[model samples]
Target: MRILGVDPGSRITGYGVIELADTKPRYVASGCIRTRNDALEQRLAQIYAGLSELIGQHRPEVVAVERVFMSKNADSALKLGQARGAAIVCVANHGLAMEEYAPRQIKQAVTGQGGADKIQVQHMVTAVLGLNATPQEDAADALAAALTYAYSRSGLVAAGSVSSKRKSSSWRHFTP
Candidate 1:
């Protein structure tokens, strides 16, 4: 099964694709979709278009996305939410199965630590996927998300087993 993970941002959305062969996760592709400093509507459109093209190229069977977390800055959080919404919409339009994970859950699944920093996550992602070099922060996060789903689906890590504080949502199909 192929999974596409997305870390949505207003300025730079990151995406990573990974395929599960048996119980192992293999890296397929990872990159960022950068948008110009333009109006919010324009940036959203760019995100939609970029992800649409990516889905077409990768043909992932499912998509995993990071859930937006509340930030100290309300404006920034709002923009982040908008970007996440755009990504979710894109995946829905493609009629793919989608899963959402929290940042902490993703970290735990990848690094065995819920509070792992970006550098730690990146290092673990590189090591786990046997990549030549560490991926960018956002891209690594995206990969971690994909790996999290892969692990859960493979029973390497049970769903919602990372913490008792949070519950994992089941994958849902979206029709456009």
Candidate 2:
């Protein structure tokens, strides 16, 4: 199954795609969507359009996003929520399955600890996915989220299966 993990930010949203098969994860793609320092709504539109294009191109079986965590600045947190809201709208429009994982869950799944720092998480992500080099911080975080989802539900995803929307059925029934 191909899982698209999103790390939404107002200025730079990161996305990573990982295919899980035979209990292993292979990195498909990972990158950041950078938006100009324009108005908040404009930035949101950029995110929405970029994510929509990415979804169309990747056709992921599911999308997993990092749930919001509290920040020192309320305004920053609000902006993050708006950015995530845009991403969620795009995913829902595609009729794709969506899930959220807390930051600690993502870190623990990838690095075996909830309190692992960014560098540790980045190193573990590259090592686990066999990436050629450490991905950018945001991109690494995105990949970590993808790996977390994939590992947590390894039993449900099938390698070389076709992905389709059908009557609610076991994930094993869908070929992704």
Candidate 3:
């Protein structure tokens, strides 16, 4: 299965593509869609159009988005929500399933700790995907989100685990 992970932001939305096969996840492509700060409408349009093109190019089975948390800036949070909504609409328009994962959940799923910092997440993402170098920070975060979704769906199976049943499946229901 091919999965697209999204980290939505008004000015810069990060995206990563990963292919899941035989209990392993591999990186395919990753990048960010950046928009100018001056034009809100144009920025939203750019995000939507860029995402649509990405979906067409990757043809992912599903899209996993990082859920929004309460931001200190209500304005920033609202803008992020708009960007996220646009991303979701693009996914639905492409007829793909959508899933939202909390930032903490994604961190824990990938790094085994909810409080993992961006650098820690990046290192783990690099190691997990066998990347020669760490991806761009935003792109790496998106990739982490994708891998997190794959592992979470597979019963929290850690990399290189040979067990039939992995960690407890309790987190499945908690996923949105």
Best by lDDT, which number? 1
lDDT of 1: 0.89
> Which one wins by lDDT: 1 or 3?
1
RMSD of 3: 6.6
lDDT head-to-head 2 vs 3, winner: 2
Residue 142 shift from truth in candidate 1, angstroms: 0.4
Q: What is the lDDT of residue 125 in candidate 1?
A: 94
Higher-TM-score candidate of 1 and 2: 1
- For model 2, residues 33-92, the per-residue Cα lDDT tens digits are 999999999999999999999999998998889888999999999999999999988887
Error of 2 at 32 (Å): 0.2
lDDT of 1 at 43: 98
Give lDDT for model 2.
0.85
Among residues 3 or more apart in sequence or in different chains, the pairs in candidate 2 whose N, CA or C atoms overlap within 3 Å are 161-175, 161-176, 162-175, 163-175
**Poorest 10 consecutive residues by lDDT, candidate 3:** 160-169
TM-score of model 3 relative to the true fold? 0.87
Candidate 3 residue lDDT tens string, 1-176: 99999999898899999999977898899999998876777888899999999999999987888888899999999999999888877776676777778888788888888889999989999999999988877788889888877997776655543112222234334355
lDDT of each: 0.89, 0.85, 0.83
Model 2, position 132, has a per-residue lDDT of 85
The CA lDDT at 118 in model 3 is 93
